[model samples]
Target: MEIGEDYRDAVLPQSRWEKRKFVRCDFTEADLRGLVTQGCTFEECDFTRTDLGESKHDSTAFRSCVFDRTVLAEITWTGCSLLGSSFVDCRLRKIKVRETDFTLVSLGRADLRQCELSGLRFREANLVEANLSGARLRDTDLRAARLLGTDLSETDLRGAKLDADALVQAKFTGARVDLDTAIAFAAAHGLIISS
Candidate 1:
């Protein structure tokens, strides 16, 4: 267990941690590339300007953490929980997520273009002004998520669950959707559909 520890600018590459607990830890500008963690919990941790590239986490929990300008390229997360975590200006390219819960997480203005986001839950997540162009959201749950000014252009939303009211607020230019989603979106905007 690590509590209130400061690891700023520390280099801990390729470290493996399991079932460890961290509370209020500051990893600002730290180099944690290729780190692997399983069943680890990090609460209120600050990852400002940290490099966590190529890191892999399984069943980890990051509650109320802050990731500002962090490098998360090629990171993989499986069955992870990032509840109330906020990511701002983070580098998230080639990130793979599976069955992750992002409930109440703030991803505002994050660029996630062409990312594969299947079977993930984003309930009540703040995705305002985020760019999700060409992203595959198949079977993803985004209920009650804030999508105001979110760019979903050319994004595949098949089998994705989202509220029609939320969908109306997002930009859906060239977005692919199922018939049920299309009908619900049209009805939410008071559009009359004729059979």
Candidate 2:
């Protein structure tokens, strides 16, 4: 379904509705805070600069949605499906995403500092230029995910399976790593250190 032509300045309310279906709608610069949007379906919608703070989104499906500059601080997402979704330049600090399916999602230039994302499967996802400093990533599968200019400083990657190609342009300064991986990283990146 094609979206409305003047959907940028449109303001939709979700105070009464629990499970709202937003299909092909544009929510640019909209305020959607303190709402319970459980099990909502948002397909092909543009959520640019929208505020979704303190919202309860459990088991929500957001496919092919563009979340450019979206303010998603202090949101709790549990059992959500975000396949093929793009969140460019979004603020996502202090968010907890438990048991979420984020396959093939792109989160470029997003600030996810100090977020908790344990055991999340992000296969083939693009996390380019994303700030993931001090985040929890224990046993997470980051296979085939892009790390172009991504800041992973102080991130926990214990037992996290990641391919070597995914470490391209990933900054892990002061991060915790094993001995074997540290040697391999220094060798692969061509560094000259003292003993």
Candidate 3:
């Protein structure tokens, strides 16, 4: 479908979209729960309050899109590129992101509780005030990311690559990390980790 030429509201929910391109489209209040998309591209699209929960995406690319108050919980994304996308006040609970690159994405104030984000690349992403409680971040890259006021409580950071500066700038109360990471964090703060 050629829905990228102009701005329009896409109300297609629970639809199967494959290899389609959507540019500058608005999906406000659209019911997209359980929608399946493969090899689709979304550029500069708006997804305000759109229900995309339980959606399945494979090899999809979302660039410079804005997602506000969107229901993206339990969504499964594989081989997706979310470069430069912004998510505000969106539900991301239980979302499975496999081999996805979120470079330069802004997830500020997004709820990512219990999400499996293992081995995902979040380089230069803005995560200010985002909730990541109980999320699995094993081997995730957080290089040069903004994390002020972000919640990492009960979140696993084993094998996660986060610089000392990034760790210091973020809130880590009750966050679970490996002993090596804990010692590194303590050492960065000039505190001695005792055996």
Candidate closest to the true structure, highest lDDT:
1
Clashing pairs in 3: none
Best by TM-score: 1
TM-score of 2: 0.82
lDDT (CA) per prediction: 0.95, 0.79, 0.86
Count of backbone clashes for each model?
Answer: 0, 0, 0
**Cα lDDT of model 2 by residue, 1-195, tens digit:** 344444675455455345667788877887777656677888888889888877768888889988888888888788998999998877787787899988899987778888888799888888888888998887788888888888889998776767676554689887776665676577667776569
Question: Against the true structure, what is each candidate's TM-score?
Answer: 0.97, 0.82, 0.88
lDDT (tens digit, per residue) of candidate 1 on 1-195: 999999989999999999999999999999999999999999999999999999999999999999999999999999999999999999999999998999999999999999999789999999999999999998889999999999999999998998986778999999999989999988988999998
- The sequence of per-residue lDDT tens digits that candidate 3 reaches over residues 4-79 is 4533355666899899999888787878889999999998888888899999999999999988988988899999
Residue 32 shift from truth in candidate 3, angstroms: 2.4
Each prediction's RMSD over C-alphas, in Å, is: 0.9, 3.8, 2.4
Model 2 misplaced regions, further than 4 Å: 1-20, 178-195
